[model samples]
Target: MSENQYAISEYHDADEINARLKELVGQPLHPIRRDKMEEYLRYFDTKCSRSKAMTDEAKTIIPGGVQHNLAFNYPFPLAVRKVEGAYMWDEDDNKYIDFLQAGGPTVLGSNYPPVRDKVLELVRECGPVTGLFHEFELKLAQKVQEHMPGIEMFRMLGSGTESVMAAIRAARTFTGKKKVIKVGGAYHGWSDQMVYGLHIPGTRTFEAKGIPGSASRHTQEFYPNDLGQLHRRLIANRLRGGTAAVIVEPLGPESGTRPVPFDFNQQVRELCDRFGALLIFDEVVTGFRVGMGGAQGYFGVTPDLTIFGKCITGGYPMAGGVGGRKEVMQRFAPGIGGTGERAYIGGTLSANPMSCAAGYYAIEEMERTNAAILAGRAGDRLTRGLKEIIERLGLPFVAYNQGSIVHLETGAVMLLDVRNPVKLLKELKPRKHMMEEMGAAYMSQGVVTLAGSRIYTSMADTDEIIDEALNRFETVLSSVEGIA
Candidate 1:
């Protein structure tokens, strides 16, 4: 499982990377034909009847008829029965290409045989959790720190939000400062403090409902790719209290939905050094997927602390964590007797045998098969074909990919100013509906994408799979063109 044995390809070249980025042309979002969309909605009702019945039953228990926000799709949520490499069969036994990949984990593919078998065997033997330490925990840590050298010390959490909460605490404790800066739109997690400015950069308190103002008073937001604004914010924080950390999703918000300059992260690292602030890269999505070492390694900009999510356990449940160098990370060390500043974070399920075993083998599998590189190639082919499709249709819909993390921006509704009721009320619903319809359109034609607007390609998506997906994608476009 040595990383050196399998050579990972470079993610992107600067010139070509910008071209792909620029080619994400659609912004205000061309609305899909209304007549065609209504037809698709009618078709969904009949086609997904079983899903509707199951969702109705689940709604009686679960608040939204689904446990997670991701499950909420057009028409109704799909209750899946089976998952394999690049494909899923829902409750009604409808087959579709699974581009969602469980929200970007399972880079090797959904329910990968090797990792799943090992996990199942371990569960049968030692059990899921024994409420005590296990060997797999140490092995998982060793595997992670082996590839990501920045992680001299590591700790696990039940979810990515917990890791973010832990990272914020550690940064403040280590630096003895209160203020934290984050790039707007770059989601770290749903933790209260980190929700100050979300969905759009510089949108302070717009979506911070149910969260008190005091919760985020110390947490400020700055525009991505704008080092000058960050400099100003850092300077402002220094007057009352120094900035403890600057948190960011290295790929920009929504995984490059708002793309950053290639050198943006490096410059942020330099600024953090100058300002005595800790640099925290929330690689919850990008970690292990961008490369064996994550986005930091790909861009050659190391952060003081890193957060991980889906890639941690390769789509297994209870997968998330934080890691950092010895000096800063040791703040989480137990047995300190509450004398020193420690970020109290741990979940009953965190680092259990099941998650640890799954992660150990999952990372091993990724390295063994050159999964990152292969997935990146699949993403390249997928995005390329999408661009050609858009051109052929003469549509302005935007499509781009950063390695395996892909985005198809049918509507950048997040960019709309919710402040203006007139414009917001007029524009939001249709654009949002466009996104949902696009997603439903893709699902009907045998593909399942993330949020109906984004995609996360996997190593399972080979050329043949990509070609199959492209055919389905063209059908989705045809729905917009009223081509039946």
Candidate 2:
């Protein structure tokens, strides 16, 4: 064994020291009980009667009273009427400073004049799809390549899920390996193969019902930040013909379902190299939002294949595909047993001109103005303000960010700490109802945010808007008192 392996084994063998280290690392920083979070939720429930009414009405027509399952909150998602710049007008004619940013795609903000004008112009000219190549496709792909030089060739899809599904298929075909290893809690779209251990945790299982057990049979799962465990799994699977690829979010910097250390990704890259497995970075969330070059550039560990979406389309319905070494991606070309043998990837609306036009313009705008840096600055200001409030209130909460992606979690630090751990675990357990309440409260106060998951900033969000949101956050948090 190598020196590093010998040292790791020796460290694990030291039972007494390991126990002490675990205890030290598991101490609570702040102690806020789960019951308080629940109480706060109950209070918001009473205050958000309008939201409930809307949800009830929506249930009659829409599934779960929302278009996407992730969009559904405890009270009900507010129906949006119109959005311009960084603000949204909901169905009740209430105005809100929108930080949701269409779940991170609207980095340039909704209805930005330039992108809007271009999309409308395209619509007027030739409708959405033509079943033929469009000029906009090449333009957008070229822009993506220009920004992130790692992506030599690219494809477009309708959603992040579709892109991820296609990337997985391409990886399997390219490597001739059937199994894939994914991080336990990182979300990578809704396909059956990538669905295992999604929102609903524990082992390899799907969050949605009716998923075939056999769908993820060859798919293995590993915890983030545990290199030894990952290596063991890779070796075990390799003995049986190896894995096609190891797919990860590359930034679980925040520990939740899978909080990873900074070195975790670097180590994972080394292991993948040793195992002869392709590494796939699912950058749908981190794509253009985190930086113009995505997480790969931020971390400086290039992957064999990378998947992108969200911010690339600038909030349009367009999603994107995998890009990597020429050889691996060439598996998609014809005559390698034709299209039937290699990855048969296609979509009716893939790379439609309208989306491509919007995407190309959006990327151009972001680069021209360096909007990503501005967005990061805004996120920093907001997170710092929230953290200050939490400290003053003596609340057990933590706030952190990855460039523009920000998250605020109550009891997150305590959950990570605490010797017994059960108390914090129970407190942090899925409080969907509480999250919905928080969302409604924020909405009523004219500040919109995702329920404890992710939030974004836009070029249109001014200092005044951010300040307003922070002040409202203080009020909402104070109102909750001992709650989350």
Candidate 3:
């Protein structure tokens, strides 16, 4: 760990998160309490009428009445009116202590003022995109390299999905290998190549529908925190052809919904070196939110390529990127790529002055206030308070966090084996439904979370805001206490 107090959030300085997660993983958490779920569903339908109306209206035009699956909460999604700092108001004017943090990008909080102002200024100044270079893009890349010394070069992209695709292409092109291995249950993105073995590790493709089996033939899975498995896989792959890259969410999928050991990254780094595989850190969720340098910096293990998502600006139009050693990053260049042939990657709206300004100002604000540490502190407060609530209510639900990213796993149903068609169809239905219900339960009580399983705190979440969130959380706990 660094004696420098600033970058301390990078390291696993606090074991409480790991300890709590270990206990939760072992504990037998049941399906969401049936009565509790029914009760919450009723409450949601009754109290969230405005949201229901909006969703109904949306479904008329949009499939499922929601654009993103993340919006598909139980009963319906809560439509937001506005958000600022640590709170958000719904269309019904109900207030919530914002914990979703826009799925881990808005460490400064939604519509953060300074960044927003800068983005507006840039939009007015340059009209979003001119297919030309902008100074802010250089500044943003410089800022990333400044904090993460591992990144000798960087490229901004459209979204985390785009970034993942670029990184995968770069890795394969740079190494002249085809095989890609990622941790089981980790979600790199929705890109076709990365759609293999998502949500649960070691499973057959669930989200790979319509994507040909051959599409994922070279892609494989390794269990998280299991270096032995990775070593074995790399050696196995070497027999046929060298593994191009080993990509992973440094803290585990969904920002440590399944937390990893403190030394996991170091072990992976060593193993990647021994196996001649490029280590790619998928920092889309962990990037700047974990610390200034990200999980690679936190663990003191730099990967050959790093995938950045939502690091540029939270909830903005354009987000995500790839930062890595100059050699690997050069593969995306127009002229002689790292592979001696251009590894194709580009975007019309990518690295526009608007997104760059938002990212540049966002980082500036976060650094000025040490937003990562403060957000992590808020996460600690929220997690601890949730633990106390769970204990008091005697609920079997689990709670743990990594820096600002929090996980409240109600069951391990998502990890169920998908290879068995019968089991897959039978188990996933109720589990998915109830999970959304649990999210709705929290939403009903003025707390908007990420699918009711995760919480992303922001620097704006003070003790008071967290306490307010906790009070709402207690209501959720009480509603679900029937199971206990």
Tens-digit lDDT string for candidate 2 (39-63): 5456436655565678789899988
* Predicted candidate 1 versus true structure: per-residue lDDT over 9-40, tens digit per residue: 33334345434444433244565677767776
Q: What's the residue-level lDDT of 62 in candidate 2?
A: 85
- Give the Cα error of residue 124 in candidate 1, in Å: 1.6
lDDT (CA) for every model shown? 0.83, 0.70, 0.79
| Ranking of models by lDDT | 1, 3, 2
**Tens-place lDDT digits, model 3, residues 1-484:** 4524232344343345545554544554455456766776786666678988988999999999888868777777778889998888888777887887777789888888888887888788779888888998899899999989999999999998999889889888888888999988888888777888788666648779989889888888887667788888999999878899999888876577667777888888888888888999998887888888888877789999998878676568799889999988888886333345567988889888788888889899988988888888888888889989888887767776776887777744554554555756676676676577778878767788888788889889889989988998887677653543
For model 3, the superposed segments whose C-alpha errors exceed 4 Å read 3-39, 335-340, 415-426, 481-484
Comparing 2 and 3 on TM-score, the stronger one: 3
Task: Give me the runs in candidate 2 sitting further than 4 Å from their true place.
Answer: 1-54, 206-208, 253-259, 334-340, 411-430
Error of 3 at 385 (Å): 0.9
Provide the lDDT at 49 for model 3: 81
Against the true structure, whose lDDT is highest? 1
